[model samples]
Target: MADRKEQDALIQQPDAEAEAEPEPEPEQLTGCGASALCDPRRKPHRFLVLMLMCSLSFGSYFCYDIPAALQTQIKQDMKVNSAQFMQLYAWYSWPNVILCFIGGFLIDRIFGIRLGTIIFSCFVVVGQVLFSFGALLNKYWLMEAARFVFGIGGESLAVAQNTYAVLWFKGRELNLVFGLQLSMARLGSTVNMNIMGPVYDAVERYIGVESYYCLGITFFIGGVTCLFSLACGLILGYLDKRAERILHRKSHGTEKVIKLSDVRYFPLSLWMIVMVCVFYYVAVFPFIGLGKVFFEEKFDFSPTHASAVNSIVYILSAPLSPFFGLIVDLVGKNLMWVLLAVSTTLGSHCLLAFTFWNPWIAMVIMGCSYSMLACSLWPLVAFVVEPHQLGTAYGCMQSIQNLGLAVVSLGSGAILDMSGYFMLELFFCACLCVALIFALLLYLINLFQGGKLNLSTRERRKLEDQSRS
Candidate 1:
């Protein structure tokens, strides 16, 4: 009876279709499962939603790099040594080390992503404003206080961004989503590096070349960018509220709150992910923070060219990240990709530390690997824990990552101050080598687990249930 009814309906559908254009052939489903699973309504909104995620953090990222770009200038203006300069970075990261975890906990339990984003965005704006004003005054302690305040918002806002991506893109093209977010982030940093020197030069014509007001105005522009981000956050919150109301989606907060004891349930793979994050960033960020100076000293590049050289990693990342992500989404074997990323990074640092080859080549290779490893790694947390714990999972990862950044950055600054760039290179190289080891361990863990973690989207669906975890 069902067959006969289907045949009759097929015949009847011809008359209906004849009046309309022919339907296009359906595209093959390439993600983890059939389109039957995800909401067709949500598809069109995903990219817009992702844009919101990306832009809401843009100012924070842009502002984050300004001090590094003006590292030498700041030292001269404040009459601070490298060790004192390191305090700026330390203050920015250390408080956030504890705050991000609590922020993540709040996102998971109390405030939802929307409200959390707004509040954190506010923190970024206030902190940037304080930092800018402090720069104008040339008060070192005031600047340090401003950094501490900005740190309150900066990383927690990042955690919110990651949580937003997971909430919307979970289990479906999440690697690509993460890659895009990262691209935007790197683009922000890239733009800051490329433009700030010129911006300083341009402003110097009006403010005088050595005036503290130049840095003040530059950072004030950054604060305006944060205002733009805050506006976007408000819009995003409204749109999300509308979506939830119309879709009757489960409000994530109403679900089970994350108990502190949930840490016991995290898989070994998750811990491996955290370790890799800590080690890898310790090498990359500290280097970039010091890169312009490194190039000026080692390669005799001009300040402008040195900033360009230093920014090569971010320059490559802006375009290549999504490409790497697409490859990972299609190819899977995420752990292998991570291993490749870590290995390349270690090689790049070694090239910088030991040889005289063009640093640009090393940076390009490291940039590609940076995107690959990052996209591959973050998504693994989604795989390791249940959906509800994702905020804490990301929080936990960022917390540890912040700690590594704080300690390594502080130490590397001191090394550069006392020992010279060679010692700093050695420190960064050692960190990368440790990161490489963790990547290898991840591969081994996958091997021992029947390689389920490595299977392609099409393959994973064949054997396992397609829940978020």
Candidate 2:
């Protein structure tokens, strides 16, 4: 133990030394001055890129939760049990367990970010089309296959999306950018939660209540959103390419590339962060996937009201994330924020499991906690890993997160089938308990190693400048 602590102390010194080194200044603007409207270095142009990057995953986010939005309808129309219904989400996650890493690697090695983003967006479009057709034909097996395809593009696209954010926004407004991305993603989910039910009803009204037909039409409409995202991906690619040309920006391909063997050398804090990501999200996402039905069964809510309650988490997230990001940026005790998120989430689950108070209160608490966790947690990876390895590192995080979500989603369904909502909530509480412990371990390790993870932005900047001098 003593030797291990000494080794970590040795590692911390070099890590700080590496971070303290000064970086090259940006290349001079060529075609236009920095203040020009069309200059990529200008705030407006960067904001445009940010907006497009945020929208890149909006379609996938909207369609991914369609099954959950219309859970009761899907089960009844498709004639599948709870476990079978959850298989929609599970299949989406299963492929990502491996494919997301490959996708990230391709971004780093094979395809540059621009091409990678486009290809993954195309995959999302194709998968959504197939999924809609499967529903139209009432073929459950076909829908599952389509979900597998969608998962490949969906999760990988997220990796591409993160890389773009870091590439353009890092060290300046990364936390806010990540927050905005999460907000947009949650916005898509929230829109689907509230809109799908009404869309289904409208289709049913027009087509005289053919169950599978209405479902097919509803999902097909959702596919339009995916198409919109693909358009954004194309335009964003063009803009990024143009910016690179104008600025004489060099690609990371010219630098030391990420290798498979690099994973073994990742800091211990990175692994601990990954553990927190896996355990914390397994509780939140699986619950959301199954929450609508739980609200209906427990609170006796009508489908619309139940969906409204179920979607509160997303609704709150959309508005709260940017605000929380600003806080994390200013405060910068990321591990503390994570611990708070886990603790609040655990409390929220306990309230639902043990009490009969208004569920809105519990959901609201959970929602804010989720926003904090996301904005704080994800940006830590950029801080810990090298810029060249960001794609691979983000991909690894998503892959492991998907694995947890896939397993727990299926297990949550079975627990619902076998035990009931109370037991299921307890299971989630247990997961949060595990997450909280990991978070504390992370805090203690960082403290012993040098306390870099807990430093506020101002202090971090001061430390960097001092080290450089």
Candidate 3:
């Protein structure tokens, strides 16, 4: 009887053990069963995510490029000159410079992505409404006010998109993601060129050319686009929170807060690099904003033709930027990127200043120059700033860069107004000269700082040990 009872107990023990084992969670089961399961810390479906994010970014930046394409019609309707047309661009930049840091800080300290994105989207919608109303009524002040407000939203969106990229892609894929995002933004410029004319023509056919209804329709479309992006951002934020919860459960409360001040110890050479970015962008961005007009006035091209030519700059940039990023990753030195950018920019300006007789030649050179600078400058941001402070650092850098754009746009507008000719071409050459000088300064700073613009943790520790020795 005792042996029988013992056998039964032993048999029951195995069944109990089987019952006690917990079932795997749905995510774990699904992820394990499928080859496509994304390990959050590892490379997952990042390429796909990058594509989606880039598309969203492209949608947002469409607003930026629209004003430039619509400038001709706006000027005709508003009875504004080239200088006032230029101010429209400056209005877009100045508020971004003022609000970018605040936006960054808000992203970092207060609103974790989900709320920030939605709020910024609302700002974009409101701005678009104001702009549309202003255009419909031909109210210049209202248009300027709307543009300035839109700049804040645009800056916030820029930081948010960059933050999203950094969070999803780390180490090996970072530069590629940055390059791709930039390319997509350029694609927004392309889309503007492609759509603006067709949209305007359709509106004119329906409502007559004198109605100004086209601008309103365009703004409404932009607002709708922002709403779609906001919806996506909200979904992403929800998924991210769920992921964070899972990570927390797995780690058992081991996460720590990332300190912002840790990034301040970056080498002086990096600051010099930032300065170069500022000057380089200042030199180039205003020209980009005003490129169509400059080409129209100087080369006797129509607005559509001028826009087609200027679009080449961004089109060339879109394809070449990724290659430049790949090269930088392969070569493992940012200085090469810097040197190439400087050379191309200098050459382009020289061509523009000296070879005005051949507009096609000038266009090609300008396109190449713009491509080089864009590819080189954007990726360098990751190397210069700490990962945690990336949003803030990028914001500050953008603020400074936008300041340059604003000043150049305003000053050049004044110059054109005073001189009764497009001095933007000459101004572009002078700005490039400043950029070249700063690029040289950056190289010198790197040389002085032991030929290392950035140091790894191990290298920094080694230097500290040597200092102690």
All candidates' lDDT scores?
Answer: 0.79, 0.86, 0.65
Local error of candidate 2 at residue 456 (angstroms):
1.0
Predicted structure 1: lDDT: 0.79
- TM-score: model 2 vs. ground truth: 0.92
The reply for model 1, stretches above 4 Å from the true place, is 1-42, 251-254, 464-469
Off by over 4 Å in 3: 1-44, 246-267, 420-422, 451-469
Looking at model 3, the pairs that clash are none
| Most TM-score-accurate candidate | 2
- Root-mean-square deviation of each candidate, in angstroms? 9.3, 5.7, 10.8
* Candidate 2 segments whose C-alpha is farther than 4 A from its true place: 1-36, 251-254
Q: How many steric overlaps does candidate 3 have?
A: 0
Prediction 3 global C-alpha lDDT: 0.65
lDDT of 2 by residue, 1-469 (tens): 1111211222222344444655345567645555565678678888888899999989999999999899988999999999999999999999999988888878876787888999999999999999999989999999999999999999999999998888777767678899999999999999999999999989998889679988998999999999999999999998887776565454212244678888788899988998999999999888988999888889998888999999999999998999999888887787888889989999999999999999999999999999999999998888788767778888988999899989998999999999999999999999999999999999999999995888888988788677646
